[model samples]
Target: MAKTKEAAMRTKNLRGIVRLSALAGLAVGGLALAQEAPDRGIVHVGGDLYRAHNNAHNTVFLVTSEGIIVSDPINRDFAEWLQGELASMYDVPVRVVAYSHHHWDHASGGEVFADTAEVIGHETMPGALALPSGDTPLSDAAAALDANGNGQIEQSEASGNLAGQFALIDADGNGMLTGAEIARGPVSDVYPPSTVYSDTRTVTLGGKSVELIHVAAAHSPDMTVLRFPDEDAAFFVDIISLKRLPFMDFPGLEDVDSLIGTIQAVEAIDFSIGVGGHGDIGTKQDVADHRGYIEALRDAVAAGIADGQSLEELQASITMDEYSDWGSFNWLPNNIAGMYRILGGGN
Candidate 1:
């Protein structure tokens, strides 16, 4: 009887423990459900300028009396989200949608604003948009984004490898990859700029003026800096990250000379705060720091080249260990190679 009672007691304890564990699991699940997704909130940077940050990408807008002028919608969902957010907060329509550069990450989803807003970009933007992202053909990209092998590209299949190649196949930003979209062909996330400018275009609206300056080919051939003189703030996308080291040679840094010049020019401007395409708001010091990093890398590469260091030698020997604490330390070798190619013998 004693043994039987002991076994029953152990069983009771086990049941109680199981019950507690189940309750704990439920509690954990509830907490998880309650926890919200990362809020890509619109940060008001004083005056009419506001920043709509989604994921790592940023789109800045100016609340004008006529309507809103936004830059770099990022993607379709983000564009829709921004539209909705604007609708909720303000009664104005989006008047102008501007492309910071021709890069897809910043240039996509402008079609959403096409009907209402005038899409603007640098003159070189159209040619850049027409070019292929890589060597991959349109048909191959379409096949890759076909995901289900259903011979039809549906939105459901927009995951995995398809997501990356979708921009290459989805000619129309209609969320569907149909033969119609494919027939349009030469797929790209970049929409044709309705308004183009060479150097500077000053936009005056709602008692505010936005000075659009074609800074340099720092990030792309047609990188435009949006300067709000009244607010003393400028949005310099892709070229300068406030805190981070930047993504892999700073993503198509073709002209380091132009970059340096652009930085100096921006520093000369009376702006106090700046917004980069892919990071937090930048102080004047952040801009200077970024310029310093670029200068140092250039100097390092120049020194290596002067020492007759080959690509391999430079890759192995050169190091930016001083920037070890920076965002993309792993990209140092790549940065070194890019600098070598640009500054050294490589074309």
Candidate 2:
């Protein structure tokens, strides 16, 4: 009963009016929102390894005799909350903040820790986090966004998620957004890493270590997978979910082949347990099953296209009942359509 009520508060916390509309059109939903998950909690994954929760999002941290190594602070509110818990429960401060990727949801609140922690990420993170200078010309898409041709995006000119974030991103409170402000991406408070690495780099803190492996462009170009050998666990985000269907119906997946291969890569890593940015914990076998689901969906969609079936027929025909017991299985239709478009079939 206690757990149930706390979860209700977490759900309520995530249902802000501004957040609801900004994420309304987002693709990562099979249900209403992550608000349905939980408010927050800390779970023990292994010796000295803990998983932090914020509604549907999760991050990991390792506590050692020296200090703590944390990954993906998640967001400002969650980070602040987690920091308070750390201060109360443990004597050590967070010595390192490791990013899984540059996506705002997982990385936004990192600034809270960066004042003291050595934040680190793949070499590409700087590029992902960089805001354009005033003189920087807008991409065709961004330029077109300047509907009034005033070289800036006004509140009225913005729509969708951009409209929702307009007031917040409009620095100087001028009710106007320059190309630089427009480049701030969807979320804010994403502090750039104090340390960046081009290839694999081992972060040793307080006698514990986490190896950041720069992975291929599966989800985000700057994605990193943190391997905690001492803890015998791995932590990742978005690239794969443990035992859950793809988020946002696997939105923007043009290279299904590459993503499946990336899952295979994850399976080969040395870890008994795996924690993702969302959903349940996983293992290598679970990773393999994840690969299987994508492979099955892709093959089904490709075969249907070859057979001249319409997108509706493909969606109707491919139920993926093998994974019917999986979480978010209701999103199978959206997943099917996503593959259909990827295979050069559906609109």
Q: Over the stretch 1-347, how does candidate 1's per-residue lDDT look in tens digits?
A: 12245434443443343344445445745644223344587898878899988777887999998888888878655787899999899888988887888776777667667778888899998877663443333366667766667555665565443443444455544455665445434335455789999998988777887888887676678888888887889898877877766667544556688878988877776788899887778788989988898899888888878887787888888777777777667878888877877784443
**Stretches > 4 Å off in candidate 2:** 1-38, 133-149, 167-174
> In model 2, what are the clashing residue pairs, if there are any?
10-39, 27-248, 28-248, 75-109, 76-109
Q: Where is the poorest 10-residue window by lDDT in model 2?
A: 1-10
Every model's Cα RMSD, please? 15.2, 7.6
Global fold similarity of model 2 (TM-score): 0.84
Worst lDDT window (10 residues) for model 1? 1-10
lDDT of each: 0.73, 0.79
Q: Whole-model lDDT for model 2 versus the true structure? A: 0.79
The candidate that wins on TM-score is 2
For model 1, which pairs clash? Answer: none
